[model samples]
Target: MHIPDGFLDAKTWITTTAAGAGAVAYSLRQAKLALEPKRVPLIALVGAFVFAAQMINFPIAGATSGHFLGGTMVSILFGPWIGALVMTAVLLVQAVVYQDGGITALGANVLCTGFIGCFVGYGSYMLGMKLFRGKGRAIVAWMSAWLSIVAASAGVAVLLAASGTFNLATALTAMVGWHMLIGIGEGMITMLVTGYLMERNAVMTGGGFKNERLSRNRA
Candidate 1:
C-alpha cells in the first residue's frame, strides 16, 4: 500500500523517516556484503517489474492505495536486504516522478511496505520452509506473500492511528480489511511467478551440468 502525503502527522512521519533511513542504510550494507555479481541483473529486472506492477494500484483508503507488492518474491529469489533496497527504490521513484505516493509520507511508506514487508515475508517463508522440511515450496511462498501484505497493512494501520487519521480499530479494519482481499490476488501472482522462476532455474542449472559433462567426454 502506498501512503500519500499528509497521511502521517509530523511526529509520526519524522520518527518513521529516521527509522526508514536507518533501515535503508543498513540494508545497503547487508546487500553489498552478500551481493552476488550475476544476480545484479536479476535484481534490476525484478525491480523494474515491481515498479511496473505497483503502478496499477487501486485507492483503498482516503490517501493510500492497494497493489501487488513484490517483497516476498524478491526475498525468496534474492534476499531480504535486496528486497528492501528494491522496494525503497521503487517507492522513491514513485514519490518523486509519479507522485503516486507523497514525499512527506515516503518514510512511512518505506518503513511499512519496504522494510516491514520484506523482513516479515522472508521470515515467514523461512519458517514455513523449515517446518515443512523444505517441502511445499509453492504453498509456503503463497502463504508468506499473503502474510507479508497483511502485515504491511497492519504497519500502515498503526501509523494511521498514531497520526490520528483514524482510531486504532477503524484504521485496522479499513486498511487491513481491504488489503487482506488484495493480498489474496497478489499472493497468487507472487506464487506463480516465483514458482516458474525457480523451476526454470533448476532446469537450466541441470541442463548446463549435463552439457558440460558431455562436452568433457567428447573432448
Candidate 2:
C-alpha cells in the first residue's frame, strides 16, 4: 500500500518521516550486530525478490490492487531488524527508480509497510509458534503473513485519516475490506515459499530428519 504524493498532509508526512528515520537508524544498529557475513547475500537476494514481487499488483475490488508484502517472510528467515532494513531498501528503490511510491510520502510508506509489517508479522509468528509448540509452523507462517498485511493496511488507513483525506472509520473499513482478500494470496505464498526454503536449508545443513536421527543415535 504505497501512498502517493499529496495523499498525506504535510504535518502527517513530516511526523512520519521523523519517526521512520529514527526507526531505520535503530534497526541498522541492530542489524549490524545481528547480521552474519553469510547472510548478506541472502538478505540482498530477498530484498530484490521483495522488490520484484511488489511490482506485480493483483486487482482487488473497487479498482484498487494489492501486491505481496514480503516483510513477514523475510523476518521469519532473518529477524525483524534485517527484515525492516530490507523493506526500507525496497521502498527506497521503488520510490527513486520506479516512482511507485511518492518521494514525499516515503517515510509514511516505510512506517506503515516496512516497520509495522515486519514487527507485527514477526511478533505474531513468534506467538503462534509458542502457542502451538512449533508443530504447526506452516499454519503460523500463514497467519503471520495474513496478519501483517492487515496490520499494514490499518496503519495506512490511520495515516489517511490523520491527513484528513477521509474519516477514520470509513478509511479503516475500505482499506481493511479489500486487504482481507489480498492477505489470502500473501498467506499462501509465504507458507509455500518459506516451507520450501526452510526445508531445503535444513537438508543442506545436515539438519534433516535422517541426519537428526543419526546424530541422536550416535549420542
Candidate 3:
C-alpha cells in the first residue's frame, strides 16, 4: 500500500516521518546485534525479490490493484527486525528509483507497510505457533500474511481519516474491504513460497533447517 504524494497532510506526514526514521534506526541496531554473516546475503536477495514482487499489481474489485507484500515471508525466513529492514529497503528503492511511492509520503508508507506489516505478521505467526505447538506452521504463515495486509490497510485507513481525506468509518471500511481480497492472494503466495523453501522434516520437528545449522555451528 504505497501512499502517493499529497495524500497526507503536513502534520501527519512529518510526525510519521520522524517515527518511521526512529523505528528503522532501532530495527537496524537490533538487526546488527542478531544478524549472522550468512544471512546478510540472503537478506539482500530477499529484499530484491520483494522489490520485484511488489512491481506487479493484480487488479482487484473496485478497479483497485493489489500486489504481494513480502513482510511475512521475510519475517518468517529471517526475523522481524531484518524483515522490517528489508521492507524499508524495498520501499526506499521503489520510492527513489521507480517513483512508485511519493518521497514526502515515504515515512507513512514505511510505517504502514514496512514496520506494521512485518511486526504484526511476525507476532501473529509466533502466537499461532505457540497456540498450535508448532503443528501448523504453513497455516500460521498464511494467516499471518493475510492479517498483516489487513492490519496495514487499517493503519492506512486511520491515517487517511486523520488527514481528512475521508471519514474514519468510511475509510476503514473501504480500505479493509478491498484489502481482504488482497490478503487472500497474499496468504496463498506466502504459504506456497514458505512451504517450498522450508524443509518438511525441520518443519515437522518445530525448527527450521537453517536455524538447526546455525545452532550446530555455534556449538
Number of colliding residue pairs in each model: 0, 0, 0
CA shift of 177, model 1, Å:
1.0
lDDT of 3: 0.87
lDDT of 2 by residue, 1-219 (tens): 899999999999999999999999999998887777887888889888888888788887778777898999988888888999999999998899888889989999999899989999989997897699667999999999999999999999999999999999999998888889999888888898789777422333344768743532221
State which candidate, 1 or 2, has the greater lDDT: 2
Least lDDT summed over 10 consecutive residues: which range in candidate 3?
198-207
Lowest-lDDT window of 10 residues in candidate 1? 199-208
Residue 50, model 1, lDDT = 91
Alpha-carbon RMSD of each model = 6.7, 5.5, 3.5
Off by over 4 Å in 2: 200-219
Residues 79-175, candidate 3: write the lDDT tens digits.
Answer: 8888898999888988998898889889999999998899999899878977997688889999999999999999999988999999999999999
Q: After superposition, which runs of candidate 3 have C-alpha atoms over 4 Å from their true positions?
A: 200-219
CA lDDT, every model vs. true structure? 0.85, 0.87, 0.87
**TM-scores of the candidates in the order shown:** 0.87, 0.89, 0.91
- The digit string of per-residue lDDT tens for model 1 on 36-151 reads 78888888998999988877776655585667988888888787888899999999998999887888899999988888899999999988976996689989999999999999
User: What does the lDDT read for residue 40 in candidate 2?
Assistant: 80
Rank order (by lDDT, best first): 3, 2, 1
TM-score ranking, best first: 3, 2, 1
* The 10-residue segment with the lowest total lDDT in model 2: 198-207
